[model samples]
Target: MPVLEIETIRGVQLMTMNRPKSLNSLNEELSSALIRAFHMASEDDEVRVVVLNGAGKGFCSGLDLTTVDSIGEQSSRFQALDEYGWVGRLALAISECDKPVIAAMNGIAAGAGLSLALAADMRYMAASARVTTGYIRRALSPDAGMSYFLPRLVGPNRAAKWLFTGQDIAAFEAEQAGLVDEVYADGEFMPHVLRIAYDIADQAPLALTYTKRLLHASFDTDLRSQLRQEFTSIKACFATEDVAEGMQAFSEKRKPIYRGR
Candidate 1:
């Protein structure tokens, strides 16, 4: 069986991390599988959104420490590629995908795993979930885009504190820090997350894709450029059938029946 399992429900690509025995820790096979899955999702026009989650006790426990131990510490180029290549690819997969990505944090997420969760467009955590920057405690600089993501989301001071101390923050605290969008009780977590994913999948496909792309670009684009880009997108939206349906529905005083044109 594959280390990663993928299922599609209501146009949402559900990617599940399957190594429960390891708390779904990252390893070579899992990383490569995830990269492939993301690429597949990106190419499949039928997939409107993605929902990510882990099975069992945790989302992920970070890198497989034993795997790194087996490789032994080395400064060789091959070692660097072995450790960082897939991580970079995974980051790219998340950043470049037009479809919205939502992470459902069922339990603990640490180090590189935490960075992966942060890459998602939105994150929903179970009340029992916890997240931590685990690199500093293990004498490592942040990788897997943790350095890049942390400061942007939580500000430099909070990111610095987390990176420097490497402490875990519970789900409620993570929500307060803006690292998590919402915290649901374990009993309600999966259903709530699925509902959100279904909601995104129900939107106009082209509009949602363009909106996700524009939002990603807004981070790097200047205000003037973003406005110009948005102007183009807004005009394009008016040409779409879904937008036509929205207008007609409003005039009819009824809920819009968006066909995801």
Candidate 2:
């Protein structure tokens, strides 16, 4: 079976991590598959949003230990520089995709698995899901953007506490700490996620993409710069056919049908 399974629902593209026997762990093949999937979504004009989830028991259990051991055996000099290699670049690609990407965490996620989820613009978790930074347990520092992301997601102090101790956080705690956007029962995860994706896809694609881009830039920009970017994007949006439809709909007091132009 394919390591990554992709399907389209409306304008949303869903990518499922398939290695159920390993709890959907990240292997080189899976990583490469994910990279291709995200690139396709970004380039496909018909795709407006992307949702990532895992199959079977958990979202992801982390990187496959067998792969790690093999890499270690192959290299004469141990190096941290090769930590992500292609996989790390894939993570960045997912993060910067023009379309919004959402993570649907159905169960526990650790190590690189957790980092992959964190790369998404939004995350929805099952009530039973959990997440942890896995480096401390393996006698190493965090990888897969964990070092840069955690402190930003949770405050630096909390990030330090969790990273140093390798603390696993429950879904409820993650929501409270601002790591997740929402939580649904395990049985309702897919339904709620699909509802959200469809709703987002129904909007103008250019507007949604610009909003996503602006949100990402806001993470690193000051208020003045972000405001300028917002003005620029809004002006750009005004030039799209969808914006004209939106205005007409407002005048008619009816729902706007956006064509994503």
Candidate 3:
């Protein structure tokens, strides 16, 4: 079976990590497939939003440590990995994706799996789901951008606490702790995620993509630099035919049909 399954719903590109027997753990094949999928989604004009999830009872269980040899055999080219060399590449792919990426985690997201979810623009969790650092238990430091994304998502103190403990955090607890955005019943999880994805996909494409870039930049850029970029972005959006359509729709009291011109 393919390591990754991809389907487009409306303008949202859905990527599912496929390895149910291991809770969709990240093998080399799955990692490479996900990296390529993110890059492809970014370049595909038909794709407006990206949604990531795993198939089966749980989400990724980190590095697939139960594989033939300590999570996976060391291929000659993969020897450079101390902690998921390819997973690092995977993280970069998601970071560079031009469209908004959402993680619709329907089950437990442990270790690097949590890191993957944390990297998304938004995260929605299943009520029965749980999350944890999943590193300290194995006497290892965090990997797959966990340290970076965790601190940014839930603040440094909370990030440190979770990393040090490696305890499983329930979905509602994660939401209360600001780790996850929202929690829904497992049966209803994907539907809720898709509903939001479609709503976002229905908006003007260029405006949405640029808005995502601006918001991501806001975390790193200075106020003056961010303001300037926002101004530049707004000007660019104004130049698009969608802008005129948006204004006309506003006046006409109807929804705008954006062709992404």
Q: How close is every model to the real structure, measured as TM-score?
A: 0.92, 0.92, 0.94
lDDT per prediction? 0.88, 0.88, 0.87
| Candidate 3: residue 175 lDDT (0-100) | 96
lDDT of 1 by residue, 66-87 (tens): 7886435556778665655667
For TM-score, candidate 1 versus 3, the one ahead is 3
Best candidate (score: TM-score)? 3
Give candidate 2 misplaced runs (Cα > 4 Å). 70-84
Candidate 1 TM-score to native: 0.92
Runs in model 3 lying further than 4 Å from the true structure: 67-84
Candidate 2 lDDT tens digits, 1-261:
998999997899989999989999988898889988888888898899999999998898888888876545434333444655755776887898889998999988998889988889889999988998887998977777888887888899988998999988999999999989999998898899989999998999999989998988988989999999999999999999999999999999998998888
Q: Could you tell me the TM-score of candidate 3?
A: 0.94
User: Which regions of candidate 1 fall more than 4 Å away from where they truly are?
Assistant: 69-84
Model 3, poorest ten-residue lDDT window? 66-75
**Model 1 residue 157 lDDT?**
97
